[model samples]
Target: MSTRGKNHSEWDSISTLYHTVVGQLTIPIAAGLVDWVHETVPLNGPGANAMDNGCGTGIVCSLLKSNYPTLPVLATDFSSAMIDEVLRNAEESGWKHFQARVLDSRNLDSVETESVTHLFTTFMICLAPDPDQIVSEMHRVLQQNGILGLAVWARPNFGFFEAAWIEACHELDPTYEAPTLMDPEWIEPENVRRGLAKAGFKSVEIKAEQQSWDWENVNAVSTYFFDGHNPGNTKWHDSWTERGQSIDKVRPLFERKLEEAYGQSDGSLKGPVPFCLAIARK
Candidate 1:
C-alpha cells in the first residue's frame, strides 16, 4: 500500500480510541505548544485566520478556539472518523467559527494561496506521507510572514511501550526487521529546518523536549499497545504474521521485559517520550 493509504487505514482504525487513550496523554503537551505559539506569535491581529493541519482529536483546535475566540479556525485530518471526533468535541464545547474537514495534509486543495495567517500541526508531520510536501503545503497556504508551528517525535528511539514491543519482536525472531513508519530525516531538527527552508519558510527554529506519561502498571501499558485495538500494535502484529511469526509467541517476553525496565514499586510506569518543536515564518 502507498504511504497515504497505510496512514489513513491505521489512523482510521484508532480514531475512536484516540481521545480516550493517546489524546488523554498528549493533550497537555499540545496545549503547551499552543500556549508557546500564542505567546510568540501575534495571533489576535485583525484578519487572522488559522489552521490545525492534521488535527487528530482537536486538542490543538480546542486550544486555538478557546485562546483566540474570534479567530477563524480550520482543522483538517485524513481520517473521517478523526474529523467526526473533532466536530463532536467542538459542538460539545460550544465552539464557534471553527470548521473541520477530511483533507490530506500533503495537498490542501481547498485552501487558497497565501490565505492563512497561522498554521499549527502537532504530532502530524511525523506521520505525513511526504513531510517535505506537507511543509510546502503549509507554506503555500500561509500569508506573507505567516507563522508555522509544528511538533514531531524525535528520532532514534521509540516510546517506552513501543521499545518493549520491538525488543520482544527481535528476541522472538532474531532475524525480524521492524517497519519504517515515516521518513527518518523528518525526526531530526536540522533536517526539518532544512526542509522548511527549502519549502520557502524563513526564520526556522527547532527545539527538543522530553514529555513523560504515567501508566497504572505494565499491564495497562501492554493493553494500550497489544490489545488488538491499537493501530500501531496492529501493524506490528501484521508484520509478524506476514513473516510467518506469531506475536502471541512473544507477548509474554515483551511483558516481562517491560515490567523489569519500567515497573515501579507501586506497579506503575512513567515513560518519557521526546519531541521536537519547530516554528518558522512564511
Candidate 2:
C-alpha cells in the first residue's frame, strides 16, 4: 500500500465550504461515538490519554473534548495543511487540551509506545494504503487494555449523498470506477477486526449507525462535490470532463435522483444515511 501524501492544500482551499457540509453530518456521528465510548470505555472519572488520528479541522477533537473534558488528547494528521486547520479551529474554539501534530500513521515517532490510554479515529482508516501498519502503530502506542474507536461510511443503503454522486457518475461515465479513497479493506468489519487482532488487539466489536449528508436539494450536494475539499474535486474532476460531461449536466441528474429517492413535499433532501462504526480494545 502506498503511503503517498494526501492533497491537503485542495481541501484547505475550501475549508469553510467543507465545514458547512460536515457540520450537520458530524454531530450525529459524534453522538454515536459518544455512546460507543460509554459502552466500551469510561469517558470521564480519570485523566485518560487519547489520540484522534487524522484530526482534520478538529471536529472529532472538539467532540472528544465535549464528551471527555478531563482527557488529554494528541490530535495528529499526516498533512501539515490539515494540522494547520486543526490548530486554527482549536484556537478559535478555545480547545486548550489538545496538542496538534503532523505525523504519518505508517510511522509514528513523536509518541512513545504503549502510552496512549485510548485511540480514536473517524473516517480515516479507509484513506490509508496499509491499514495494518496503522493498526500496528496504534497497537504500539496504546496501553494494554486501551480502546480504539473508529467510524467509517457503510456501503450506501437506501439513499445518501454518495449514492447521488454514483448516480451522477453513471450519467457521466457508464464505466466510471469509483476510486478507492475509502479503501474497502478497512470498510469491512471482518477486515477491520482481523487487522486489529493481528495488531494484538482483542474484543473487537462493530456496529452500523445510520447518518447522512442533509441538504436543501441536490444542488447543495453538487456544490459540495465541486468545493475541492474531497478527492471528488481533486482526483475526479478531469475524468468527468474527459467523458464530455459538465457539472451543469450532471448536477440536475443527481438532484433528480435524490429528489426521487428522498425528496420532501417541498422538494428538499433530508434523512440519515447508514454508516458502520467499530470499537476494539488492546
Candidate 3:
C-alpha cells in the first residue's frame, strides 16, 4: 500500500476510539488556530469561508460552529471514518452550512485553486508523510491574502508522560528503544518558516505556545495507557508486542511512573504540550 493508503487504514481502524484518545488535543490545539483566524479575518466577514484541512474528528469545525455559526465550512481528512465522525458531530450539534469529504491533504485535487479564504491544520505537519506537499496544497487552495493557520507539536511535549513511557518500556525490556515521534526539524520554527516560504506563503508569523489537559487522576492516566489509543500509547504497545512482551507487564510500572511524572497534589494528572503556532499569508 502507498503511504496515504496505510495512513487511511491506520486512522480508520481507530476512528471510533480516536476522539476519546486525543484527550484535549482536538479542541485546545485547534482553538489557537481558530482564534488566530478570527483575528486575521472574522469568519462572518464578507466573502469569508474556512476549511479545516486534515480535520481530525472536526474539532476546528466545532469551534467555528460555536463562534461563527453561519460560516460556510469545509472539513476534509484522508480517513473516511474521521469524516464520518465530523458529520456525526455536525448533526448532533445542529451545525449548518457545513460540508465534509474524504480528501487527502497531499493532493487536494477536489478543492479549487485559490478558493478557500482560511485554512487551518492542527497537529498534522510533522506527521504528514509529505508535509511539503500538504503545505503546497494548502497554498494552492487558498485565495490571495488567505490565512494559513498551523499548529504543530514541538519536542519534549507530552511532558514527563513520554519519559514515563520510556522508563516503563525499559523496565519491561532492558534494551527497548522508542520510535522517534516525527522528524525533529519540523518542530523548529525556522524549518516551518522555510517550508511555508517554499510553498509560496509569505508574511508568516510563528509562536511557541502550549495547551494543557488534566485527567481525573493517576488511575485515569494509567487507563489511557492500557487502551494504547493515543500515539504515545500506541508506540508503547507496539514496542512491547514486537519484543514478545505482554502489555500487562508494563501496566503497574507505567502507572507508578506516570504518577511520579504527571501526578498533581490535588489527585489529578496534567501536562503541557508545547507547540508551534503559525499564521501565514498567501
Candidate 4:
C-alpha cells in the first residue's frame, strides 16, 4: 500500500503534462505491442480477456480496443488521476469494451489467478518498484497459453529524449546510476526471454521496433523532451538537489550537447527514437 501510494503520488504530480507529451507516441506503441501479441498469441477468438497493466490515461486501452473491438480489456493503473483520465477518455471515445481500474502491478491477487487471457503493458514496467515481482504477478494472472506483450526503451538504440536524459543525469552526478530502461535491466530480446522463462512462462519471443520522435522546435526541445525525468520534476529531485545540481542547472548543458550533436534548428528538432517490443506466452 505504501508503494502504491508513492507510485500514485509520483504519477499524479505529472499526469497531465506526461500524458500530453507521451499520449501521441502511445498510439503507435500500443499498435506495435498488439501486433506482436497477435503474432504470438491466438487473439482472433471471441470473449478473450485482456489486461492492460499500468494503463496511463487508457491510451493503450483505446488503441487496443480500436484494433480489436471484441476484446474485454481491463485497463489499470496505480494512480487514481490516471484512472480518471482513462475512464474519461473511454467515455469520450465510447470505448464500451474497456473498463478502468486502479491496480498495482506488484499485486495480482486483486485479480484472479489464471483468469486473464492476455496481458499487455507499454512503458510501464520500468516505473515499477519491483520489476521481477510485477513480471511474476503478470505471469500468475495469465491463463495457460495466454500471451504477454510489452514495449520497452532500447538502451543503445533509444531516442534523443533518453540520450539527453542519460547525459543530463550523468552530468548532474557522475556516480549516479540512471533509471532502468526496463525493470531488472535494459530491454533486450534475450533478456526478456530469460526473465519470462524464469517466471515460468513458455514459448516466449520478442520483437524490436524503432520508433523515432520528431522535434520541430529546438528551443523548447530540452524542456519538452526531458522535463518528465528532469531533476526538478522527478522523484529524484531531492537526490539531485543534495548533490548541488538540478534540471534547472542541467538544461543548459543538455541544450549545448544537443546543439553540438544536431546543429541549430530553426524551430524544429526532429530525430528517430527506437523502442523494443517483446512478446511472450504464459
lDDT of 3 by residue, 1-282 (tens): 011222353567567766775736557767867887788777789999999998888788888989998888999888877888888888888888888888889998889999999899987777767888889899999999889999887773345467887798788688988777665657788888888899899898989877776788888777666764666557657867898887877888988887887788998888776778899999
Order of candidate numbers by lDDT, starting with the best: 1, 3, 2, 4
Candidate order (TM-score): 1, 3, 2, 4
Best TM-score goes to which candidate?
1
Clash pairs (backbone) in predicted model 4:
211-273, 212-272, 212-273, 215-269, 215-270, 216-267, 216-268, 216-269, 217-267, 217-268
Q: Write the per-residue lDDT of candidate 4 for residues 32-79, one digit (tens) a residue.
A: 778767766666675587888988777677767787777788877888
Error of 3 at 57 (Å): 1.1
What is the TM-score (0 to 1) of candidate 3?
A: 0.90
For each candidate in the order shown, give its overall lDDT on alpha carbons: 0.80, 0.71, 0.79, 0.70
Better of 1 and 4 by lDDT: 1
Candidate 2's C-alpha runs over 4 A off are 1-10, 156-159, 169-173
lDDT tens string, model 2, 1-282?
012245454445655555567767876786677678767788664757788887666677777777776678788877666777767776776765678877877788888988988788877676656877887898889988888888876552223655666777797678876554466667667776777778788898888667755678666765676654575454556666676768677767877777777778875778676666888888
Model 2 error, position 213 (Å): 3.0
Query: Model 1: what TM-score?
Result: 0.92
Query: On a 0 to 100 scale, what is the lDDT of residue 249 in model 3?
Result: 76
Better of 1 and 2 by TM-score: 1
Show the colliding residue pairs in model 2.
211-273
The TM-score, computed over Cα atoms with residue i paired to residue i, of candidate 2 is: 0.86
